[model samples]
Target: MIAALLQGCGRGETPVHVSQFDAFGIRIDMQLLGAPEQLATEVAEQTAQDFALTSYSLGLEQPGPMQRVNELLATTEPFAAPPALLPLLEQTRDLSERSGYLFNPAVGMLTDLWRPDPVTGKCSEPPDDESIARLVEAAPTLDDISLNGIELLSDNPAVKLDFGAVIRAYAADIAVANMRARGIRGAMIRIGSDLRLMGDRTGQPWRVPVLRGSGGAVLGTLDLRGDMSVVTVGRFQSPCFRNGKEYSRIIDPRTGYPAQGTQVVTVLNSGDAVTAAAAATALFAAGPQQWGQIARQMGISAALLIDDTGHIHLSPAMERHLQIIDRNAQVSVSPAWQDSGPQ
Candidate 1:
């Protein structure tokens, strides 16, 4: 962005420590400005362990606990898991309910039918129409999955768990929490598309960019002044084609179809990346017409939704936060989400 243009703001050594690694099928870029080397190293190790505990990596000889839960849900018997998973399951259920079932972690069956091979990223063919329809009709929500203590069971055999919707965000939370606990002054943790910013660039807020079509153009800037989360959902990541039509990997559990109609949906919230990430996916699937309601229900005041037509809609809270540098974009502020002054 315009980091050089920024004046009157003095941040000490903007992110002196940087680390790059790959995990959970996505790349991770971490920036730490003022943190001890020994502690930073420990934080990195903890982040990876946390991700492994929460992610559902399939097609491996031994799947993680997330995948194991999916296997249990596929069967009739209850699967006993460690108490560590309680928070993950609990939060996912809350997100699913709040989003009106638009955010579903138990969508493993649906995703498996649409996605390519995880390692090679190639698909023989997309799932047939009949199979998709059948799975969509039978897809189970969190209400169908019961959790008691450390045991989780799905009464519906069709239910399968896939934490794709919010895994990265929650993992970022874990990493951020670890860093903060270890006396890190400021850190930016990005897991795939999930972003979490702690502290500022001296006196200025963290400048975050929202991408436009295919992520080539900058839609605007969301300056995060405090601890907050920002996430974007778009069709550009890991696209698949079927019958000469392209589709995003994200699936709308409500319709059992690969979600479209929105070029990108970016969400901002007070302090957690997981909810922001989940809401972005849910709103992206909900489409332009339904994003306002989804944001309201999820208590997200700041959001930007870009339709396939390149029209940008901003919520009241998001309008206050976003400084649009992209004049070429067709932008509009929604009165439904935010109120105009001097009315």
Candidate 2:
């Protein structure tokens, strides 16, 4: 029973309503608002389709532009020169660099080794130590990979774009762009927990539930208005198990291990949902202290981090926007939030 409502003011029209279904492990919902009756259905359908096409990892199955791109990426030899694959390759390269090469080559190896089961789509146990060591030995670094006009290859011939981290956000960006171009004003696009919201809910804020667990029991809620986008990152959203030990899907590209210590982190920004989501994931992987430093350095607007110790850390900007309704919730506003200039 996933439901959302979008109400408009002075228009006297019924608020747009949307419901979601699970598609390829992603939650997809679409609703039309402030659009003419004839166009609403068309817009909704097109938007949903576009979102699915771009966001679904399995969408790589079809033989289309993106498919062609992915195939080239998958089959191309390490250090091969392929001009057609340059854009995506370059993008991947940049992300790796910006992430301090925290986007490590071993991460992909680990992901493949700890591959999710095809049948249940659940993560299986880590592969044999020999396999892991072989992968690690074969892992490529930025130095190994060179991108000159889209032809990418590692000197060692092992590292490559996993696309798992960036693909969802990329799709969200494309979908939002499509919606705006089609004159759709108010919409929420969520691929799994990665979400993007455009405009306000009419004149009011778009309320988002912040849950404590993957089961969706609410911890708190956020009311985002204007052009802001919100992205939540946490272990609770994507749980995995290995030999009966639980692990999160948020892999630390550096250690080829799952991130630990924090429960959930939310980032709000005026940028696209994809950027927000990616940044949030990276920051979460970086952990709390480093995350705070990065957020301050980047001038990030709002950040909320919930640790395993049941402590909540709110950035200065986030405090202005936060309404902590759970009295029993152990929360602490960061000094930055407390000292943030002039309300």
Best by TM-score: 1
Top-lDDT structure, candidate number: 1
User: TM-scores across all candidates?
Assistant: 0.88, 0.79
What RMSD, rounded to one decimal, does every model reach? Answer: 4.7, 4.5
* lDDT of residue 132 for candidate 1: 84
State the lDDT of candidate 2 residue by residue for 1-343, as single tens digits. Answer: 2344434424576456464644445567655556655455556666556556654432332344544433444454543454433444456555555555544432454666665675677786666767656655565554555555545544453554455566666666666677788887877766555567787765677787765634365667788765566778777765787888778777765555678877888888877654466567777777765676556444466888887686788877777777777787777776534444543
What lDDT would each prediction earn against the true structure?
Answer: 0.75, 0.62
- Over 1-343, each residue of candidate 1 has an lDDT whose tens digit, in order, gives 0011112224544434666666666677776665555566666667666666555442222456556666667787887865656787788789889998888877778888887876777754777888888878886888888877777788888787676677678778887777788887677777665578898765577888888867777877887866889898888877887678888888998778888798788888889888998899899898877888877888788888888888888887787788889888888886555433321
Question: What does the lDDT read for residue 143 in candidate 1?
Answer: 81
Q: Where does model 1 exceed 4 Å of error?
A: 1-15, 52-62, 335-343
lDDT of 2 at 32: 52
